[model samples]
Target: MNHEFMDALNEIVESKGIDKDILIDTIEQALLTAYKKNFGQAQNVEVEFNRESGDIKVYSTRQVVDESDYYDSFLEIELTEARKIDPAYEIGDIIRNEVTPRDFGRIAAQTAKQVVVQRLREAEREIVYNEFIEKESELVDGEISRATPNVVYVDLGRIEGIMTRNEKIAGEIYKEGQRIKVYVVEVRKTSKGPQIIVSRSHPGLVKRLFELEVPEIEQGIVQIKSIAREAGSRTKMAVKSIDEKIDPIGACVGQKGIRVKHIVDELGDEKIDIIKYSDDPAEFISEALSPSKVVKVEVNEEEKSALVVVPDYQLSLAIGKDGQNARLAAKLTNWKIDIKSESQYEEELANGTLYAKEEKIEEEIVEDFEADEAVDLEEVAEFEAEFAENEEIEE
Candidate 1:
């Protein structure tokens, strides 16, 4: 290595954020290994580097010992010979002799080049991994670089993120070079480098988009309680407000529906329903089945299930095509919902099944109470007539 090489090393240190000392130590180790392999491993040698000139040198070291104690000349030098080189040498002192071969510079050059390149690649991978691991479960924008049948690759600047078929929105077309937003689902460290798993179908993507568009949500005035998504079809989000003055649904919807419109456009026109969150499961389930008016909701808290009633005309809307609305509502509330229309509920009531038996028992109790009230009114009227006749006689 030379001064020009040192200049390049400085550039690597500055650009890659790798410590210069670490690189130097790594290169020195590599050079030592090369020397041992080419020369002899039996030699006790240490490699050193010149910081100023970037010169590398290998030194053969031996321990000085008395002639009586010296058994191996390779590892130990006699005190008389050590003293000839340096009179200050003691029996236990170490002596170093330069053993750098004439052609060793060429070998050192090749070894250092390989070591630096490999180290630089490793440092870059570490840098990318650390940078993206922090971004898991967050939103990022990238351009579509390419697509295969099973995967779509998004160029995320320094690294590429893979979106598997399962992570893609159904029926959505991805064109090369198209700018898109995605949610980071996972960051994994692999032998190749960091693998970023991104998704458009994840419900978190919708939540993040809302956070970006709605200031109220980001400011903590309005908070999203839950989200259920069908990706390319529809999404249901439940939101609540910490400040009573702020309407969470209104805040997410924005004035003139502009905030949600932007989000919808970004999502390829997927429909979004922003509903107010309620602690009451019945009320929440009713709100979750949006665009369909619910007549009543009966909840079984222990079972985490509910029976929902809507107008006969709204039955199809409540169930949606392939029961998507009802399915999303169930997912959003974490409840199993059975939706029935008014006519179907009445039929069930007539058959005395499901809630019908309870309804009939309640009716019988109401009738008994009404009969007792009627007899009480009759007896009071009879007493009033008797008092009138006595007052007439007194007059």
Candidate 2:
């Protein structure tokens, strides 16, 4: 090592963010090991480095003992010889002598090279791990690097993130070099390097996309209450507005639906329903089953379950194909939902198999009566009169 080597070392310290003192200490230790391997191991030695000059040196140490007490020449020196080197040397004092080999600089260079390279690799891995750990549960843009039968690898700048089969959007084909957005599901450290698990099917990806598109959501004027998704098919999101003037659904949908359209395009045209969140569970459940009109929602709060009634014609739409719509709605509202057509609900009411809330039934009857133009006036009047009489009789 020399002054020129110190300059290069300084550059590495600055560029790699490595501690200078620690690197020097590690180099010294490496040199010590090299010295023992090359030279005889019979000598007790310590290695040192000159910070200013970047010079490496080795010293052999021996403890002074009386000639009669000295049993090992490697560990103990006769007091007479110690005193010859330094007249004032006393018994039990340690004597150090420079034993740097004539060609030790070459050996020191090789040892330092190995140590620096190893440290650099370790530091880079740590940097990458820490950089990505903070990004877990966040969105990232990457290019598809390659794909296996069960995994897709994405180039996320400094590292490749793995997206497993379960995390991929169904029916969507990925190609190499395709630019896409992914959700960072988790970050873990492994022996090879940092393992980043990213996802395209996570519901959080939808939520994050909304946050990116809707200024109201990012600014806290609108809050996303919940999201339920069947990736590549449909998703239901409930949102509420903190400011009454700002409509949460409109803000998320953007003017002319441009904002949501961009998100849909990004998601390969997955359908998304942006519904207004409600404090009332019944109202929220009704909104969650969107595009399929809900006639009524009867909730059992204690059981976290709901019985939903839809028009006969809207029953299939409410339940969706294979019950997907109803399943997503239940997940969105955290309630178990039982869907029934209006006629089925009426049949259950008559059979006394389903218990309906009294207030909800009264509200439905009143609503029916108010829409007299849609139904026979005499029938509405008779039903209202009968309901009132039943209530009075019960009271």
lDDT of 2 by residue, 148-236 (tens): 77999999999999999999999999999999999999999988889999999999999999999989999999999999999999999
- Return the TM-score for candidate 2, rounded to 2 decimals: 0.82
Which model scores highest in TM-score? 2
The parts of candidate 1 lying over 4 Å away from their true place are 64-73, 76-92, 342-395
The global C-alpha lDDT for each of the candidates, from Candidate 1 onward, is: 0.93, 0.93
Clashes of each: 0, 0
Question: What are the per-residue Cα lDDT tens digits for candidate 1 across 1-395?
Answer: 79998899889989999988989999999999999999979568999988778999999999999999989988999999999999999989999999899999999999999989999999999999999999999999999999888899999999999999999998899999999999999999999889999999999999999999999889988999999999899999999999999988899988999999999999889999989899999999999999899999999998799999999999999999999999999999999999999999988878778676557899999899887754777778999999999999999
Off by over 4 Å in 2: 40-43, 64-73, 77-81, 90-92, 355-395
TM-score of each: 0.81, 0.82
Worst 10 residues of 2 by lDDT: 351-360
